[model samples]
Target: METFTEWRTWERARADLAARSLGPDDLVVLDRAVDAALRWHGDQRRPTGAPYAEHLFEALEVMVRGAGVTDLDTLVAVLLHDVVEDTDATVSDVEAEFGPDAAELVDWVTKPPAGGQGRQAKRVAKTAYLRRLREAPPDAIRVKLADRVSNVQTLDRMPPDFQRRYYLETVTYVMPLIELLGDDTGGWFSGWYTSWRRRFGHLG
Candidate 1:
């Protein structure tokens, strides 16, 4: 059964947002973000072959429902976070459409290009990104945590090696980042990751 807390689909996400305390203007902004994400992602799919929008929705839902975030700009950034990294969209494009706060938040969470080829270089870039993420604004950190949660929550669908790599990265960097917060969102993620580790620790 689909619950208010689980929103991997637009229909569930929209319904959950409607039940929240957003004003009309907030809804408009979020709607534009959704439209932009879908349009820009255009047929993109996850490694498990789910529509890319599903990941976006899951992140946004984690922010709103799981983390109790309701700020319009933060939520908008959650929806559009991957747009700059994975699509032709740029930070300027995000800023022009969503304003500078959302732009900065999205840029803070977006992974920089790898400096060299192959897995080693990509690993370096990813490591650098996670370390840099430690200094991002609290909202950006939340966005990244929510993004990682959505990404790693379903690792079994991918190869075991990928699962192991992601688990180490999450524990080494992302989980520590959450620990530093010591806030409500941090508590939520602590519980979630602990349970997740119990289920997937063997793979790691």
Candidate 2:
């Protein structure tokens, strides 16, 4: 089994991404966004007990390096994608630091407003969020696809019941968004989804 040290290597593997040819301003913004994310998510851990920043970094690496996305706004948004959801940060904070485009992409990818909604209502809200991604800028959806790929890769490490629900949710609420990302990302999503379904489809 991979230890935490081994898992942590994923962060270091992004050195190649950091070394990629980027414009001066783009590199500056990427560094600033990464620094901010590290500060905001300080010592935070995921439910799987991994450092939360690892997930964010992995998503950014995939979107920027793997997907060949060099847009500064999209890259910055990828870094701050979970800030509003997991930290005390606000969309305004991201906008003030990064730009309106970054803030808007983050907002577009964020889960919908949750009120006194029941389970079904929450599911409906989630579905709505996925559908909204269809119209979202391709950059935002690309980051979301990277996030989903990371989550799906680790689903087995979660509780069995939770894993089952996540699988169903991915197929129902998330797959369509992947489908909408179009060809380049669609291929990645399909390959991951197919592998996941082979392993867990029996649960559904």
Candidate 3:
């Protein structure tokens, strides 16, 4: 499913969210989450040199447009998923701003500085994070799966080593979570990623 994952701008994404059957409070929360993300991620760039908000927008679009997700808190958490991990923001800061539900979901998906110093430590930390995702609530897993879909959708743009490594990580840990969902939407995501993996046959 080549669903449109790029909103290109937050205004465009906001418009799409508005077009949905959301109420005033939903719009307000979404707007605040977008503004907060813009402020906290100011001047940051993705590895591909794109504006950082582009990634957040892509994740939002994946959940909303691609996965048919409409939960207000999940959408909000998707918007701010990386803030606590990448910025100086804390879970408490998120809780103060967006309340507990969003904060807890974000915390579940946030990768801590778990393993410590070296490259091996970093790998261990990431591995642990992925493995621990098994215990995440469904909405939190939805956030993560959408985030990963956005990241992996452009795999051809990354280096070969990164592609293989990420593909392995995705199939090994991430796809299983989708399988656990045991529903049609989850099957759709799993199929889409499986086709993505097939497209880049070298990942096999």
Candidate 4:
């Protein structure tokens, strides 16, 4: 079944890890990351009306269950990835709390500022960001690949025109990163993109 849901609570995250045979050390990092994400993103909601934390949880699920990632820093980075973009949180703040590795991964996935530009300029900024991903560390690329997977899972809720533009952007910008993201994880993201195109082709 598709993993997209309205929200994922801490209990659900615990259950997901337990099912995957991740150990206590994994649990500790994930718990701390989740707590921090909630503390920072309290009351924020995605455009789809889901609590913002669900996006982070789903991205972690993609990394762990879908990509078989057990790395603590990678998982923690997924949880805090959007904090810098959506909140007042900074890369230094994340580094101070979770360490340099997580902060770096978050930075790789974080989109640079568009300077309050219009849609076209924002697209240009995103294109530039995707190009930079080609040079990012492998784990950082994986985090972004997983992030795209989570984001696309809810794409159907978007307006038709927006869906068309987003699908095109994914193909043009994100598809090339598959090689940088490595085989298993990259393959999953490719499959999601392909299937999403077929499912939403009319919008495109």
Best by lDDT: 3
To one decimal, what is the Cα RMSD in angstroms of model 1 from the true structure? 2.1
The residue-by-residue lDDT of candidate 2 on 1-204, one tens digit each, is 111122244346345556676766777777788888888889999888888877877776666555567778887888899888778888999999988999999998888665546888877777777777879877788878778766766678889999988888888767777666677767766676677677777768
> For residues 1-204, what per-residue lDDT tens digits would candidate 1 score against the true structure?
112227766777777788886777888888899999999999999888888988988888778877888988899999999999999999999999999999999999999999999989998998999999889888898889888878887777779778888888888899878877778888887888788888888976
Candidate 4 per-residue lDDT over residues 1-204, each given as its tens digit: 355452377798788687778898778877888888998898999888988888888888788777778788998998998989888889999999899999999988888898666988887787888888889988888888778878887788888877888877777777778866666767776776677667767765
Residue ranges of candidate 3 with Cα displaced over 4 Å: 1-3
Colliding residue pairs in candidate 1: none
Candidate 2: where is the Cα deviation over 4 Å? 1-14, 117-121
Output the better candidate (3/4) by TM-score: 3
- Which is the better candidate, 2 or 4, if ranked by TM-score? 4
Candidate number that wins on TM-score, 2 or 3: 3
Per-residue alpha-carbon lDDT of model 3 for 70-121, expressed as tens digits?
A: 8999999999999999998999999999999999999999999965688999
Worst 10 residues of 4 by lDDT: 1-10
- TM-score for each predicted model, relative to the true structure: 0.94, 0.84, 0.95, 0.90
Model 4 CA deviation exceeding 4 Å by range: 1-7, 115-117
Ranking by lDDT: 3, 1, 4, 2
Report RMSD for candidate 2. Answer: 3.3
Better of 2 and 4 by lDDT: 4
Give me candidate 2's TM-score against the actual structure: 0.84
User: Candidate order by TM-score, highest to lowest?
Assistant: 3, 1, 4, 2
lDDT of 1 at 109: 93
